[model samples]
Target: MPFMIGRAPVRRTLKYLESGKIVLKDQIKIFSINYNVGQGFKNKVHEGAQAFVFWTLPQLQYKNPDVQIVTFKNMTPSPFIRCYYEDGKQILIDIDSRSNDEIVNHLIKVIGKSKQVLKAEALAAEEKDNPANFGVGCARKCMCEIPGQIPCPGVCPLPKVMRGKYFYFKKDELENPEL
Candidate 1:
């Protein structure tokens, strides 16, 4: 009942959920990164990989929940990123001696969704969010269209007492009093 301003944790969490709904291309099923923790010069060769993983891992995991991402430290001689596709094909990109930005740019160029695809997806999401749209893809669609589903409050107004606006009236006020 108290009004508040500034950053709300609940709003941030919901925004995170909304922003991370992007699904990776259907072919990409697994993503794996192998690197060594910074140590001696030989191992240090993969410092980029270490930095890249730290920065991008969380975003990748959240953005593409369907894709399994696995990381291995001190497991390989050199740092590399491997993407496994549903067709059993895999792409290996060496990240040794590259900067974090370079690694990210290279990966995006090779494996990220195309700009056109992203635009189409964004458009579809907009359409789905439109209040005037209904049925299968629209979020505002009436649930009653589905078998056995009851109509929602928007489709069939709830009884007065069950509605939020009802509380604004005086206790003794009639629902339909003469003007």
Candidate 2:
């Protein structure tokens, strides 16, 4: 019988097992196939257990075109569904004793979520659109020698290309009004 394993704990345990640091024979409980299905055993086995997640590769591929990477983990201590986002954040949802339709609904909700947290802002600052100006420009000959202007040699420092006429100032130059 296959058992759900927690991702991190299982990974570490597997690594230790591979390096012969831990004996699997001594840890029989960890590998036990025995399950406690006392009261609602028949119902759980017939209903919940049979509710296996059925997802097609084509469906996932077509639905999530922007998904560059995807991974699945089965968590124990009552089955849980966990997903990792590109921002190095994880979202875990417990689906223990849930029906197949309910699990699918939860999965749909997870898939539709974007990986951004809500930012709190005052009412006065809520309508403002702040843009960043990092002094990105083309190199050009200046008629007036500005006190803090640094000339670029006919090349963009960012791309290191000679095609554009661009120049930028150092942090010190930008901060200081005088040379």
Candidate 3:
């Protein structure tokens, strides 16, 4: 309940991850960055890529657990980012000479979910958590409504014969065994 105090109730950690502010689109499956650890321009690019990775890696991982992130240092001649999608499609962005902020901003603009998408996701989550709502889209409806399901004892009283009190015999009945 403490976790639900200020925010909408998240049914699971996976759902919570999906509703993050910078969630990746479902199409994207992997993110790979290639940079070099050299002098001058390469060093600047390396610093930028390192900064971007340091700052955004955890967020991306948390937001999209299914997405794989790979970083290659001192392996490529220049810096670039590659995004692999579910349908065997990929998008490569050149980050050869961009600064740290520029790299972050550009990648976010190109790959991260848009503001509207985030808003819609947040609204959907709120609606799902609404106490008044029920059924499939909302918090679970009445359990008793399901076919062949037993109603909760706290919600619906058990039949007299099924109750614990019914098992106890009155003092008179106990004494008069024939009755």
Q: What's the best-to-worst order under TM-score? A: 1, 3, 2
TM-score of each: 0.62, 0.30, 0.60
| Candidate 2 vs 3: which has more TM-score | 3
Top of the candidates by TM-score = 1
Tell me the whole-model lDDT of each prediction, alpha carbons only.
0.75, 0.39, 0.73
lDDT of 3 by residue, 1-179 (tens): 46665433352345544543456687999999888765684477577776666655556678778999888888887788999999999999998777767876776688888888878988987765755454776555766665677797888888866766656766677567798
**Winner by lDDT:** 1
Give the higher-TM-score candidate: 1 or 3. Answer: 1
Pairs of residues clashing in candidate 3: none
Q: What TM-score does structure 2 among the candidates reach?
A: 0.30
Model 2: runs farther than 4 Å from truth?
1-52, 55-58, 65-75, 113-179
Q: What is the C-alpha lDDT profile of model 1 across 1-179, one tens digit per residue?
A: 23234434333343444543234576999999999996786966888887777655656777787999999988899889889999999998888899888886787778888778888988987765655556766664565665665678776877878766676777556555763
- Estimate the TM-score for candidate 1: 0.62
lDDT winner between candidates 1 and 3: 1
Ranking by lDDT: 1, 3, 2
Clashes of each: 0, 4, 0
Report the lDDT tens digits of candidate 2 across residue range 56-134. 2223333344553333333233555455555555666665677756655555555443223212233436644333223
